[model samples]
Target: MIRMMTAAALAATFPLAAAAQVAPTATVAEGTLLDVVAEGRVNRVPDIAVIRAGVVSQGATAAEALSANARQMASVLTALKGAGIADRDIQTATISLSPQYRYAENQPPVITGYQASNSVSVKFRDIARSGTILDTLVKQGANQIDGPSLTIDAVDSAMDEARVDAVKRARERAALYARALGMRVDRILMVSEGSDGGAPGPVPQMMVRAEAKDSTQIAPGEQQVSANVRVRFLLK
Candidate 1:
């Protein structure tokens, strides 16, 4: 969203905080200025994929459940490594062991069994084969799967492009306003930028059969990087 900070009069209808910081006053003979808040957006295709894959096991005893979970989780990790996933790109996300209980109508709940779960978060630099890798992890005893948040690894360049666009747009807006008022843009008084944008969060996963007929399909759409800037220009 973009906004125009014209004068104290413009602030009469806007929030006090925003109005208070409206176009700053400058000591000049003309005493005319325009402040514009502009946003710049740049879109780039995502180059990486992140996912969470895990194993859950159950047994009559805690030791049994833990051992079973460990064995299955080991296979899952090995599968990721076999698919060229580096150790640095993989990290443990969760690990838990809890006793299962049976609810009885007439008495206290009884302990039935134990459950063990272990999960890992993984980053795939190769988005093309992410789906196939996901399926392979499932076959390797990963029963719980989540995410595939697509993102760009290095965002500085994209952000820089966006910032440039914002400044350009702000200048254009100021010029338009000056033309309408029969005045000309004289000089830039200030240029300030806002904070960075948010990254995509984790997405839910649908359960698929471990034994699939073919390699899974993955589609990584474009991601957007945005920047915001506030500019104050002197008008003559």
Candidate 2:
């Protein structure tokens, strides 16, 4: 019985001794490794614009609603072509026909009418006239206007700017860390990139009623395009 008790005590103390032996190695490995992060941001002016414009018509029948919507949208397309929008720049985005419902206190929901809507995506090369174009569209018959989401069509330049900024930031960090630890930075052990996720500028909304004879007011304020990047550097 005494021998068995001694064996049990030895078994319990073995793990404690092993844990004490392994603790120092883990601490040393963690101390020698360092992780660094650097961020870069750049702002540029937007050069391209995208607009979503469409027509909405409602009538007693689905065919009538769809016909009315088609007629008005055709006129809108003609006006856009006259203003220099290329064929490739215009695309039909949506066409939806839904029944209009009316409810009464004592009766089941009745189909009162039907509505048809069609939307188009328009890209503008000349941003100066974007507002004027909106005004023209409303004057013609466009009832639904969604956006003028601004963008920088050529993103390569913006990406280049971000890359340069990232390099500068990484170098600045490496110098700071080297100074602090009294060690010199040798070379970049690894370089990995994090995308900025295609930065979009801004989208402003403009509203116009069909009853208005003249074009709606347009205001295209300055839009800011931005880019971001993260870089990691190693030290010796």
Candidate 3:
């Protein structure tokens, strides 16, 4: 005769087997990792203008050349001050006195005279008045000039905005990838920032019309600040 086993008896006889069957099996599956890079940019009007103003003078001797350069540079400094430029904003960039050499076909090079140069980097907080200041510098003996590099004086806010945009774009891209691969985005595992294009650099110099009848005009177009980011996401 066969005897039917009750539930309690089955549990007692095969305790481990019964526990395995009823144990929770809803564990989250391992997700596929993905990495994506994205870039974001912000455009804004520049607030400041940087320009290099310099004087070059030549004389028969080094002392004379330096003296002439000093006189001219003094006038340039005075002009800058008259235009309301702060003393801290004017920084000496270059000061040099080199011997002028005359190259000969057969004989050795001869020192004909000396050339001296003095330059300062000037930062103009007022973009609208920078051109007028530049013209005044020219009239005051600043012959060698370069750059009116337009840039935002305070870029921290703009950079932050760009960074946020970069993260947003990265997330969107990651979601798109997850959808394409028939999966859903689980979470972001890691995030890292890359290059920041908002940092200022040496901008190429443009032509300055100092001799024009009207005052010099400076047009600061929109400047772009960019940020790059790399994100790692888990998709399941």
Candidate 4:
């Protein structure tokens, strides 16, 4: 959710200027100033999936481990491309080679073997194929799978809606306050927008891996986007 926030300092910052509206000699204009803060939130169905997949291989030597990991990772990348994943949508996330050690009670740790891992982050624009693609990746030797985080690729429209709602709420609150004080809103003095969640609210379902035989159910749950705004109204 996006919300608008303001502190008493805001009004204090321009105390002299605001007081000038009433009279040069007036000490305060409490009845003539109205401020309100409000927040708006909107929900939308996610249309994109972010999948992090990788391959881990172990061997007796560092080179052997790296070589095996490379072979598996290559197959995974090839499978992703064959499934229509573009190069730009795929990014190398991590690559590492670590030595395995055996712990002994009466002796120092001994080097046992070497393990190599490589991971990539893949963005699936087409939600329908997200599950199928993931399944294919696993079959193609992706042993280290992390997430299928869901999100909406384009959030401009949803963000606009939230902003509109926030503005509406702020105006309503200002009007209510003015009416309670036996005054009417003359005009909007200032309006400030607040920060938003940017991306979707939550990672709805963080998928680790798909079940065997059954198709992966990539459920892109409804995402909530919020906006907040603060408004200062000139009352008469």
Candidate 5:
């Protein structure tokens, strides 16, 4: 009989499995999900300046090219030291020696000469004198200059301030939503945090010639730091 088979199947199952199916579920009116976005901004003053600059030289032989590059890099390092840069703050970024080539329509490329390059990274504490230091580098033999990325030396306090702003904004938004629905905020259910590291703006490329008369004029403008937060609260 159908009833007999059903009873037999039930008897074969474990007691825990049968109990799990009959367990009581929480009883409450289902609530709707409301997503809110809150943004906080903080204006930070930069404390350190990082710059990349280098020397380029050409010679008939690889050794000669490297020797020339070394001499020019030495002079550049000396200029940085004179400008109050410490050895720990200055580092050689790259060094390379390669043969230059001349190409023809039907003939194989011919080695015309050898070129050597040595690049260095410099960090400066005094940002106001950055332009003058760049001028000094060019005068001493730096042919390529990459960037002067401005950044804050420490971010703990700034980040904390930003977090406070974000939380305040989130609370304001939640209150507005609750009031619209004819209710008051009861308790915060959850909070989620997000962050972004600000990227530096564009830097233009320039070729400095030894015969140039004026120092390179640089303008380091203000940078923006942004934060976002999400908060969930119960409605009373």
Candidate 6:
């Protein structure tokens, strides 16, 4: 569902300084000014899912840990490719080799083992197949996984819709104010965009197990795309 809200204030005079700050091209006309702030929102189901998948390996030496991690990560990448993920959708996110330490009562910390990790960010255009592919990645040696951030792949259309709604709301609000003040709206002096963005719904991180019998399920509920606009109307 789409929602719209508007707040308006009537002013006898508009300061030229404030008008210049808000919109450089705005020209202050000779009339009572009505400023309206309107917000429009559209709710939509997410079409894309982004997840981070990786492998972690530990060994006595850094070389051994890195080698093991590399081999495991290779399998994970192969699994993703086999699942119809394009190379452009997969990006290497992190890679590191760190020393694991062991502390004693009165001695300096000693190096116990080395841990190596490699992770990649994967964008799944098909939301329905993401859960199953995640399960397959885990079975193919991915031990570390994060996210599944649901988002709208194509947001331009939604944003344009919201913008139109905001403008319409602003015009109605200005008309209402003009009527109440025993005046008529002559013309719109200026319009400027305020805070505008899409808010994605929160999704919990999945705790996947290789031995689990149940299949992983991903649910992308709904996200809201919003647009805010400030409009100035001349009342005569």
The C-alpha lDDT values of all candidates are 0.80, 0.65, 0.77, 0.76, 0.71, 0.84
Cα lDDT tens digits, model 5, 1-236, are 00112111232322221111222133213443344557777777676778899999999999899999999999999999998889999988998889999999999999999999999899877777877898899989999888777777766666667777877988888788778878776655445665545545445344567778877655566665666666545555
lDDT of 5: 0.71
lDDT of 2 by residue, 1-236 (tens): 00112111221221111111111112121122223444555676666778889999998999999999999999999999988899999999999999999999998999999999999999987777877887788777888888777776667777677666766877777777777878665544334454453555445666666676665544454543333333323344
Each prediction's TM-score against the native? 0.86, 0.75, 0.76, 0.83, 0.79, 0.86
Best by lDDT: 6
Model 1 scores a C-alpha lDDT of 0.80
Tens-place lDDT per residue, model 6, 1-236, is: 12112213333343323312243255445567667889988889999999999999999999999999999999999999999999999999999999999999999999999999999999999999998999999999999989988999879899988888988998888888888879898877667777689998988578899787788989889999998877776777
Least lDDT summed over 10 consecutive residues: which range in candidate 6?
A: 1-10
Off by over 4 Å in 2: 1-35, 198-202, 210-236
Taking all chains together, the TM-score of candidate 1 against the true structure is 0.86
Off by over 4 Å in 6: 1-30
- Consecutive 10-residue window with the lowest summed lDDT within model 5: 1-10
Candidate 2 accuracy as TM-score: 0.75
RMSD of each: 4.2, 12.2, 14.2, 5.9, 11.4, 5.3
Candidate 1: misplaced stretches above 4 Å?
1-27, 198-205
User: On lDDT, who's better, 2 or 5?
Assistant: 5
